[model samples]
Target: MKAIQIATYNKNIIRALLGLKTVEKSAGSPGDDEVLVKMHAAPCNPSDIAFIQGTYNIVKSLPAVPGFEGAGTVVETGKNTGHLLGKKVSAFVQRDTDGTWAEFFVVHRDDLIVLKDEMDPDQAACFTVNPFTAYGLMEIALLRESKAVVQNAAGGQVAAFVRLMAAENGMEVINIVRKKESVDVLRQAGARHVLYENDEDFEQQLRGLCAELQATTAFDAVGGPLAGTIFNSLVPDAELVIYGGLSGKPVENLDVMGPIFQNKIISGFNLIDWKNELDAEDFEKISGFLQDKFIGGTYKTKIQGSTTLDKIVKGLRGYIANMSAGKILIRP
Candidate 1:
């Protein structure tokens, strides 16, 4: 089987791309609780980029396959996972073994989400990460009974799904984006409240909107001063949920008095952590709900383009250049 192999980790993205090579690899068999999936389509997500650069939370050894999630048909099932045979599934792998970037991937049965017959393969390719991240963030907001929420990196897919889920639950979203065009794009997508972070009066607008909407929950993906701004601007007792570090900086300019005097709180969100807290029954219930939304076309990941395994280096560069444009799929 052919797989995209990275022999070394490079913080410089260009060097990382230069290091990617497609090589013939021996396909490994599954164990008792595992299944072998014939890869259909995998996506280049931000997490994959970070993983390749050795900056992500979970890093495998050198010469590892980089994909974290994908969708495919289970061709070979282990003794304990026979029920998944011949099923179309969306799966994610966080193990040190080879990943979904190859023609064949072996993953534990617990990591698989059985896809609906109506779900598109391209969408399923991106199924595990962003959607679940958004779901977990919204669960925090809903648990707090928040009427509205604010999120930076609102142009990303997870933020897009958050907006849709908020609307469905009768909550509002105050979206913050860096570019003026994204403000327009989100508005055209029916986002009621969008803010351009570079605007001169951006802080003023965010503060006023937070008060008006009584938004106490903030999802912060880009750290740095922006996280502080959102943290300080929210109503008292608000919760700031930090998920991603896209800005590559620490949180700054935070008002110490808010946490000291007000009941404000800062927390971190991890998709795996959230998923672990749920039992099998609850996990299945939530997964079914989310999949139904996709089947109904209520949730969709924008797809910019696709490439074969041989052309992944070039395709991934395109994706890194314009991630907000959409995702780039790798078909094996």
Candidate 2:
């Protein structure tokens, strides 16, 4: 088997190297509760970079194989889990152990989600984090039909998912991006309104759009000064859900009057916390919803780039660039 490992921890310092010879090791030789999978594709998400930089909530020991979600085919299974053999599946794994970056990995049979045959491996690899995060945000916020929502980093995969899901639910989406070129990209992806953060009249335009669209809920991933701006532009009694801090900085302070006088609320969300509360049945239900969306062409994953295990450095660097409007995949 082959895998990629971080030689060191530094965001500007690209430390991943490829073609490292390794042996796949599993616990208890695949017990009845486990299955061995030959990983086909895995997406490189922002969390993966944070893991390497030791900034993520879940830190990994050095020389770690770092990937969170991936899709693969079950090649071997314990007697009690034999039913899953030969099935294509996707999963989220523990952080410290050998992850989807390797050619082979093992996950509990219960954790191995059977994906629909029509779902492509690349799409399945990119599925869990962005889609589930978008769903959880909407669920926690108690969004209503016909109400409008706002999202920052609208060019990101998760933001794209939120826009599409909101549209399907009969809600309007006001997407905020930093580049003018992203306007068309997001609009084509179903964003009802697109605003550029770097525009000279950004705040004024956002207020006008919010007033015109009646947008009250804001989903902000780039939490910094941008978050404070988004919070201020909300209608009275609206909510702001902060999910990611891509700015690598803290959210700016806002005047106390907004929340006290306007009756607005601010909340933070973590996908792992939400997943811990769901049982297998609930998980399957969410998976079914995602599967249906995929089948109906309501959900789509853009591929920024794809590479084999040997080209991991290039892949990692590409992800670090943070300009691609899609997920990067690695085949191991």
Candidate 3:
């Protein structure tokens, strides 16, 4: 099997720090609840990037195969595995001992999620992380009965999913982006509140939009002072959910007094922790709903390009160059 193995950590230019090495290994016999998957495709996500950079909260060993989610076909299964052979599925490899960036991968049979056949490989490749994050976070908004929500990185793939899900749930989003052009792009995708982080009216527009829509939930991906701006812009006693640290910096400009004065809450949302607390039934229900939405409408993700195993460096660099161009797929 061939895999892109990261042997060293590089805070900057993480893609260059990783390498694709041809590794020879045996297909271990599956256990009663395990399956062997012939990998078809995997998407390079922001989490993967952070993993290789050695900055993610989870620490991986040296010579790590860093990847989170992907889709493939089940070629073999254990005795306990029932009726799942030869099925194409989306898989999440949560084992700290293993990763999915390879020609073949193994996972628990129960963890294999059969995907919609009509779905594209790129979409299936991204089946778990972004889509679920967007879907699950929206539930938080719904629970708060928030009329409107705000999120950063409006030009990102997950941001698109957030906007689409919000629209379906009767919630408006104040899409925040560093680039001015993203305002138009998000607007075309049905975002009514698009604010530029670099604009002089950034704070003004944010305050006005929060006041107008009564936004009570902020899904922040880009950290740094951007989070602070978002925290301060929301309605009273709102929730600020930090999901990603795209800026690779601390959340700045936070509403320090909100918790004390307005009873506001600031929390973090990690997919792994969220998944752990959920029962199997709830996980499936949430995953299924998000998958249906993804296959149905604006949930479709645009793919920038595809690459094979040998072109791993090119693929990683390309994705790092401009992630918003589209989701990059590794056709292993």
Across 1-332, the per-residue lDDT of candidate 1 in tens digits comes to: 99999998888989988888899988798999999999999998888888888889988987898899999999998999999999999999998988889999999998989998999889999999999899999999999999999999998899999998999899999999988899899999899999999999999999999999999999999999999999999999999999999887999999998899989999999999889999999989988888888898888999999999999989999988777788999999
- Name the best candidate (by TM-score): 1
Model 3, span 243-290: residue lDDT tens:
999999998887678877877888888877877789999988887776
Assess candidate 1 and give its TM-score to the true structure: 0.98
Q: What residue pairs are clashing in model 3?
A: 228-253
Candidates 1 and 2 compared by lDDT, better number = 1
Count clashes in each candidate, considering only residues at least 3 apart in sequence or on different chains.
0, 0, 1
| Model 1 stretches with alpha carbons more than 4 Å out | none
lDDT for position 83 in model 2: 89
Candidate 1: residue 291 lDDT (0-100): 89
Local distance difference test, each candidate? 0.93, 0.78, 0.80
On residues 134-226, what C-alpha lDDT tens digit does candidate 2 reach at each position? 999877545433388889988888887787777667778888997789988777755668898999999898888777878778898888898
Ten-residue region with minimum lDDT total, candidate 3? 14-23
Enumerate residue pairs that collide in model 1: none
Show model 3 residue runs off by greater than 4 Å: 14-22
Q: Best by lDDT, which number?
A: 1
Q: Determine the C-alpha RMSD for candidate 1 after optimal superposition of all C-alphas.
A: 1.0
TM-score of each: 0.98, 0.90, 0.93
CA RMSD of each candidate after superposition: 1.0, 2.7, 1.9
